[model samples]
Target: MKFPLRLKFFVFASLLAVAPLVLVAQNLTRLTRDELRSAANEELTTVATQLRTEFDSTFRGRWLTPLMVIRNAIDSDALGVSQKISLLTLGLEELPQVVALQLSVQGSDLPILVTNESFSKRLVQNGLDPIETLTTSDDLISAIEGTGQFGRPLIAQISETGDWLATLALPLTSTIAGRQVTMAAKIDLSVLGQLVKRHPFAQRGEITVIDHAGRRVLGEQVELLTTRSIVSSALPLIVAGARADALEPYTRPDGSAMLGAYAFPDWFPWAVITELSEASAYAVSNAITRQILVVGLVGFAIASLGAMIFARQLTQPILSIGQVAERVRHGDFTARVENIRTGDEIADLARRFNQMIAQLGQRLELMKFVSEGTISAIRKADQDGISRGGERSSVSVIFTDIRGYTEFSERVAPEVVIEALNCYFEVQTGIVNRHHGDIDKFIGDALVAVFEGPDKEQRAVTCGVEITEAMTSLLEEYPEYNLHVGIGVASGEVVKGAIGARNRMDFTVLGSTVNLSARLCSKAAPEQVLVDQATMKAGQSKADLQFNQLAPIMLKGYSDPVQTYSALRHIQP
Candidate 1:
């Protein structure tokens, strides 16, 4: 069977598109897998470092406590063997990691005392005397003499009856008896194994801890302690002050390929190793590849069928209209359908839609221009009350003026002055909007705004505090420009509307309230927020605000003195 020319072309185009999509899918999956693997390795290294630090700190504390107590006992001749035994018992009770404490004379073959009863019983059961076990070991004797001369603790690693032990030996000098003694504390290595068991690896990964000799100290395998680590070759490098963390591929004991990250912690004689099977690590990439193949096949079949059905109905005019609509959606309002003359309903529909879109675009542009030039609330009110003059409403009026702005502008260039002013205004405008207020206008370096609502007084006060804070931050960014503002707030009735000549008009609030606010602003000090008594009383219910009443003062336009208050506290949003 033969297919139509369009049908053949459709099948070929679908194959072309699906080929690149399938390749991209596979590449993206591979890249994501590599990134995830790297992140996992880094996280494992961090965890290992933290665990090693915690263990070293705990071990040092356990070792040093008994050494200090024994030295104190030797300095006082009043502390005999019985008194020393009491101090050792107290040290053992406090340090959970210390299994036993022993005291012996330097170069002696017997211990003067042993604190742990369990350890004494264990020595007897194993046919070893407690004194001989403490004195006959060459490691213990060497550690004692070395620590006495150098004032450092020595750790001796030993295994007894399938259990690992670390004994810390320190030397104490008797000022009274004029002799040197050894104080030793034994710590159980099984605690490290238990700690490793508590923090398991992710998925099927494994964690291992190895001693300085590259002998496994703790791991998932019970036999690990008896075998040397496979990465023992790296131990010399670590001892020579090389970095502890590395990524390399190796084969596990089970003959499975694996990727591992190893780290040797600082100030500790141990290495942490983390490993994951290579097959498991690549499982996600494999699954993504299979999914991409299946999806490409299904998408190609669907595209071929869809092309066959739509090939005949798709015309030039329809394509042109679709293109125009897409451009309009992306904010290209100038786009229009061209050469759409089919003499059918589709052609007429395209013409009418184009006209509608053009008209909408013009209206939106005009609205945006007006909104940017004036306060949004006043613009809305002007549209609603264009026919009428204005409306009378009870509102709170706020006025803020930059102090010393005139002198500052005279000192700087025009561009610098404009830039600094614009930045300051931008911050203040946002503050007004957030407090449910509308900016009336900016006159020189001054701003006029109005707030209308049940909470108008509180909103205006909060706006003043925020504006002061915003200006302080702005001055920090532009340190060359020294700028500050003073704010005044008053509450009363006002006529709000667009006022001025027909060609050029401004939306503003006009009343005695506006005059009082402006006058108070002129009288305010730098960074001060002054409010009329009425506004302070209205916002008195706000618990977070602080107000102090000022003496009544006469204004330029008022016959009676106006009672006012200063907003003393600044609250953060």
Candidate 2:
């Protein structure tokens, strides 16, 4: 009851092949996912650093200095109408970022100097001359008449003007009143808009500054803007009349979620708020995820392919040994293994299988002589034998070949010919790889590859068309070679696996589908791609291309000819 030695080896090889594929698949999946998250986090951290630096510099350099100058002018004994006016004007002109700078006297009817005639006229037009009304506002008078600057930068609402402004009320000690007077410098709301507008995410997000009184000091009050009284929310969060960064998640008018960071500037108790949309701020993460999925699919495919190869290598030898073992069990000692694979377990298996077969052949007279039986047995027993393991996913495939390689190769020297072929393949290969395509195999001057595989779930037809277009541009880079390529594409469930005898295995595809596609390649004109109906159907919406139906033609092995189409041009990616 001895089994053939070849059969026993084949079974052993099958077991070896199957075990590794499962392990390889698991490792590949874990590594790919982890790398995806790491890359995304790094990008986000870089963006945050940039935002922080930009905000710090913009506030200190542009808004703070002029405020101090206006405060000093009002407190000086030497300050007269002319000197105060000169100081305010100088400060305003020097700091273009400042919208208003002024000095007010204690219990006096007017500010000594107000920069910008337009603002002065606005006050005059409002029925209170800038020079006359400064004295009547009891709050202004009270603030100024103090021993020192009465109040710090108070982000308060000025009912006189409905617009929001950051006001710094610095008190000045007046010798005349035996008390301090207040000098106020205010910044307009438009400044925040200008600053936030510079962000790449600004269109998707916004920034807002709110004052101690729960009034917006900078940034527009969009419809979704909300306020929790500063006395209620911020007072407890800060030191006694000091600064702090208070953050919270808020939603904008358009329903986008935002992250707000608040900072209180000293000159004005106005809270400077920087807000970024949750989606917009973390968009790079999503992009990274997409990139990872693409790259992962590729790695997984490569791994899966490698696993299958390993499986076949492992299975073939064992299967061969098994057959020999079965034969020995039947007492056929002379059933010798032929062409036993060299160098490894499979080689060892081949040797053992040969030994058993030799014993069987010597002991029994019922064995059939097979050519390369032992080598074939070991390979069959090798676990890394050809096997199918893949999930059905939408993917892109591109096939390309030289249009005139037959004529071109004849003219070039064999060395030069090989060099040119390698050069052409190398350049084109790099291009396809960059675009994330998996190299299938090459046939002389032709290439076949897939995209959006275990790595990318790309639209195969669209990618095929894109590669076609891209290749045209790429071929131009190698000016020395007047090369033109034709491509053909058909995407379906094609069995992809390692196929061949023993150690001389090749990763390739089976099923008439792939062959039919290759045949389409032959029919295509120079620089043209003959895509099958299946590819065109998949790419209907994704590709921007022109197409015309080619007459049904009979393939050599098939009884019925299949319908095909010629893709004239590409439309999109």
> lDDT: which candidate is best?
1
Give me the displacement of residue 283 in model 2, in angstroms: 5.0
Best candidate (score: TM-score):
1
Instruction: Provide backbone clash counts, one per model.
Output: 0, 90
lDDT of 2 by residue, 1-573 (tens): 987544454545554554455465456645654564444334333343444455455555566555665666545787665776677778877765455655555556655545455655666776755554322254644654463544443343334654344455555665434544556666554454455557664555444445555545444342222443322355444445566555555665667665555555454444555555555555655565556566556655665666667656666666666676777677666555555564876787677666656555553442222112223333555566444332343444567788767777787788887887777677666666665666667778988776644423234444455555665775687655667777777666666554566556555555556676677777777777777777776555544566778898776676888788877655465
Q: Where's the lowest-lDDT run of ten residues in candidate 1?
A: 220-229
Q: How do all models score by TM-score? A: 0.43, 0.35
| Model 1 residue 490 lDDT score | 93
- Against the reference, the lDDT scores of all candidates come to 0.72, 0.57
